[model samples]
Target: MSSETTYAVEFAKTSRAKCKKCSDIIEIGDIKILTTTTGGRFDVTQSFHPKCYTLPRKFAGTVDDFVDETLRDTTEGQILPKERDALVEAIKTSSSATKKSNKAPGSASSADAIIEKIKAMVDDGENEPQTKKAKRDDHYSSNEFVAAYRVYQKEKNDELKDVLKWNRQFVSGTKNYLLVKVLDGHVNGRLARCQLCQGGRLKIDEKNCSIVLCNGQFDEDAQQRIPCTFQCSIEDAPRWKPWFTEEPSEEEKEKMDKLEADATGEGAGDSHGDLASMKKEAASLEWNLSNKEGIRSATEDAIGLLKKYNAKLPEDATKAKQKIGPVILAHKRETPEDIIAALWKEVGKQLSNEEKEQKDKALEKTTKVDANAKLVAAFQELSEYYSKEANQRAVFTYSKCLNAIRGLDYEITAENAMSLSKGKTKVEGIGTAFAQKIKEFCETGTMQKLEEKRADHA
Candidate 1:
């Protein structure tokens, strides 16, 4: 056989090969291209979906020249006329996109010049509306409050106590209570510190409507402590910065307003309003119970509320269904609270088992060094590159493949790399495209894809 490189196009015989560009699996019978490069005693072949195939820049020839070369004296597979045309069009489109991407910003191209003219016309306010910029605030919405509460719930009891102490809030409560208190303080704008006096701070007074400082001096005449008037919002405090950076959407704002109104008994006079409030509260508790760390406390709170309003619960509300793991835990003959309790138990078991498995896998990874460390690093680099490009699918595929490679106990050599994807000991996430990449790295000491990525970034 001639010691030359060749390319051939054919339909995929199996659904094992992944597209090089997209990192997605090509279905069986899809048009694919195989490039074979012969060097010394070993021949390496890489497969790609036809649309993903890019002509080598080193090949100084036209599309027809490359096609002629591909068609010359090859009997293994033949490219159909229509497929050949598609291949040519794909190459041209890929090349055009590559060139456009490679061009720097503000480059003096005809396309850029036209874009500049359009941008200039828009900048001159020809037909654009003069809308005022919306003012931004640091108010936490319902979703943000829930998310922040989950994070706070994950902290240790001692740490949560410290946080409450720092904020001068109530330090005596269960972990869930502390979590909810801290989050509510920020969300409701009730947590504040007096800028006038060092000893001045306020606590939530559930019974009274007056604002009295916790450490303020009591007056015998007024029969009340002096109120602090220089209070400042602690929402932008550094202590809460990590948890509450997300801004709420307009929908979240409306939901939060309604929830606050319900909490304050704004429209609880009618039975309909009372029932609606209970359902909303139950839904909020359900969301909180979704977090594994808050399961116990949230479940207790949920059970208490259910007991209080169980008789008022509608039939459909009591019969609401929840999916936990693979099993659907429904309220066939039980109350809504019973279904919730069952969900909590099932989810706790599943979470415990998952945590154990994760710990075991982490231990395994630490004990055994990756035998294909270089290849794993290359794939990791590609994953990061795809992530920077906002190619989420490609990033996920490469990340999964690299993680699988990290778990390999044996080295990937040129001899065994090809069989590693097909043999009984096949890696879980390695598709044909990644297996070929492994073989290429083992033989050439570098991946062409990685090199191209480096070149592009450079």
Candidate 2:
């Protein structure tokens, strides 16, 4: 990998831009990281919000390796010391906030506590110079670093005793270690280091060496380990290959060059703004599949784009759906209609199990009520549990039955309801199964199977 000096820079955005990774709007004044690339077919520039920026693969495979290069501080383009600390704190804060939010009801106090924790770290720098220097140099030496890495590698095997408990795994292509051939005292000079603090250096002794991190710190003489707050890890790697002597190509070189955009990639002509508009429109509209004309028209539009874009509906869309991204990817071939239909499907799936059960039970109890009210109740229950065809059937029966009964100016009793369900006189939307349910309800004052469903739900 190329030296770290060629990697990334953090700068405040002067104007609006799109986050290259998420393709979302990055408003003006947001702190963003701009990455530079050169020697490519085009001198491509991509900018990311700090949260979204990952050390690209060409820089270093693992966070450990990235830290090593960062600590080397051999070049100006690399992240500076203070910036590096801020980035590390940002990542830690984000992780901590996520865990806390998942486990408890997040309040302002909880958020304040996290801010204070980070603030405390920042204030620690104000200590006496000697104390600060001791803290700064508090890292592992060559031997202890390697030993910590071995401990990290051993922990992967569950049966191993006296091994560190593994907490997390890095994504593929980002691991720090690979199996490498050893020569002399090094695996191509890829030394181990403090993966957490990124402050120490360690020598590689074994051929199949894995990178390790330790929480142990050292005094100024670097003789003995002392307790350090930094947690240890053998993250981003299990094995590594010997450092290659091959020179990087133009593409690889381009990846190494860290450049920021000369100007924000947003303005009057920006597509992100248009996507935002579409997303807002989609959200403003109510999602209801029972509206046949509305939903069918929307679905038809979506189906057309589905074919054009060759995309499938997302597996889980209820949590938060990004309609505009896909629509934009489709080259704006889609309209808000497609988004509406997609959102409707997501809304349907998101209906709670408890809500569905309640609807089912209530549907049975309401069968002897007003014919129009009973059919509406049935349709609501059907929408929750029945197949698409069944729901459609209920929709049709509700509309047609209500219209016929109202046209006759008759009260919704058993005899009047049966008129719409019997023989050749059947209503246009009344199917066999639905007609049977109506007939049974009219004569017996209840639908038997619906009552059974109510019992099961209860």
CA lDDT of every candidate: 0.51, 0.39
lDDT of 1 by residue, 1-458 (tens): 56778787767789988877788998997777787889648997777765666678887887667866753424354666776788788776776676676774333322233223334433453333332111112232234454445466457778877666544466765554455556555455434332222223444332221222233333343354443222112232212122222345577546544543332223222223434444555555443334445444444454455445432122333222122321222342444444544443332211134434533332233213535555655665676566556676887787667667665677778898877678796888888898999899999988999988865543
TM-score of 2: 0.20
Candidate 1 vs. true structure, TM-score: 0.26
In lDDT terms, how accurate is model 1? 0.51
lDDT of 2 by residue, 1-458 (tens): 23222444445446567888678887775556665566655566676666666554354344545544542332355556676677656544554555566676233223233223223434554344544434332222123233333434333223221111111111111112211111111222333333222223232212212223232234333344332112111222122223223444566433322110101111211222433443455555443444556554445554434433323344433212344233333333444645534433322122235534533443332233333445444433333232222344544445454334333333455555555666766666555666667667767766776666543332
TM-scores across all candidates?
0.26, 0.20
**Collision pairs in model 1:** none
lDDT of 2: 0.39
Model 1, position 85: C-alpha lDDT score = 82
| lDDT, model 1, position 125 | 39
| Winning candidate number (TM-score) | 1
Q: Report how far residue 358 has shifted in candidate 2, in Å.
A: 7.6
